[model samples]
Target: MQITASTVSLTVDDVAASRAFLTTHLGYTVQAAADGFASLTRTDAVDIVLLARGTEVLPPEQRDQHATGLILAFTLDGGLQDQEKRLRDAGVEITMPLREEPWGERLFQITDPNGVIIQFVEWVTPDDV
Candidate 1:
């Protein structure tokens, strides 16, 4: 079986607020919005979706108790600096600041209002060609 495009979706509290934050701050466009549910699309190559709830959203669980440390990461062609600037301009909170590691990857993290962690990274190496 061949898996094509996919998205991680979840209902969120305050659909309008989430919509505004994602669209205005993240450079995402509205793919669909109505009836208390909103779907957004990322402008980049990946078709990432952000879904907001129609009714009251769930409150965040107590940290270290949730037991799930799931995070989404994307390697940007422009690297960490560009994405850091983009996230900053969009008013997203930086959960983890960018720092170089011994693995030759520059990475940073940000969290959405719903607490989804998004890491933007770039690989570093000397280019001979």
Candidate 2:
């Protein structure tokens, strides 16, 4: 099926904590929020949803194990290091520090409090080539 939109609902230990990270660090606009769940829309048209376990949106058993072997990656343009540093300053867990690959793309990695990995990247310019 052609997926118009998809949402990754993560079970968080604290809903407000997850919301703060999603909004402040990841730059998501909140579409809706309640005691048990929060729906968010990324400016880049990405669909992301966060559901608190044992709540209306997701049951305790239905909550993802966070070991689903999945990571939510975002291909971003602009200054990779600056962005990575900014995120790091904002309390995002920089699981992998910013570094340039041998192939020459500047990239960095960070994961939210919920263990969602995000990749921030920038293309190598001619001067770097």
Candidate 3:
């Protein structure tokens, strides 16, 4: 089967808080929203759906579960440093400072208002490693 798109649904304590954080800081646009739900989208990233914990739209067994132990990671084409700098300039606390690994992977992380861990990564050329 061909997958046209992808989406990640996160159950948070405050849907509005997570929605605002994504749109305001992570360049996501609101696809749809209601009292306790929000669908956020971006051209270069996966779609994100924020559902308030306990929302009935979720399965009964999952409705009360909160998003945890997950890192929403995005691999970028380039400009990892500039992106981190811009986020820092916007007063976003970098939860994980930008660092490069021996395998040429560079990454950093920030936590959204709902405590969702968002990570950005970029890989360097072998020559630059």
Candidate 4:
């Protein structure tokens, strides 16, 4: 199969809230939007689709489910510290402070209004595995 792109669909209580957060803070632009749905895009990141919980477009079994226990992580080639500082300066609360692991991974996390965790990671050394 030839896949051209990727997207993450999130079932949120407030689609507008999540949409605004992504556009305002995360450098995403609204590609399209409607009463209960929004499609956001960032040139260098994965596209995000926010669907209001219980929206009819979702399958009956999935409509009642909300996005949880998931972390939307972005891996950076460098500038992990700079990115963290920029986010902090922009008044974004750092739920997980920047920390480095013994395995040469550095990461930090932030939670959006809908409780979606966004993690930024940088590898100090190339993965050996």
Better of 2 and 4 by lDDT: 4
lDDT of candidates 1 onward, in order: 0.66, 0.72, 0.94, 0.92
Query: Candidate 2 has which clashing residue pairs, if any?
Result: none
TM-score of each: 0.68, 0.74, 0.94, 0.93
How far does residue 11 in candidate 3 sit from its true spot (Å)? Answer: 0.5
Between the candidate structures 1 and 3, which one is better when assessed by lDDT? Answer: 3
lDDT of 2 by residue, 6-57 (tens): 7777766666777888789877888998886778897575777776656644
Q: How close is candidate 2 to the true structure, as a TM-score?
A: 0.74
Tens-digit per-residue lDDT, 48-70, candidate 3: 99999999989999989999999
Ranked candidates, highest lDDT first: 3, 4, 2, 1
Cα lDDT of candidate 3 equals 0.94
TM-score: model 3 vs. ground truth: 0.94
Candidate 1, 41-111: lDDT as tens digits: 77564544443443434344431132126676788776568778777886778899988777677889987
Better of 1 and 3 by TM-score: 3
Name the top lDDT candidate. Answer: 3
Q: Model 3 residue 126 lDDT?
A: 53
Residue 35 CA displacement from its true place in model 1, Å: 3.2
How well does candidate 2 score on lDDT at residue 35? 80
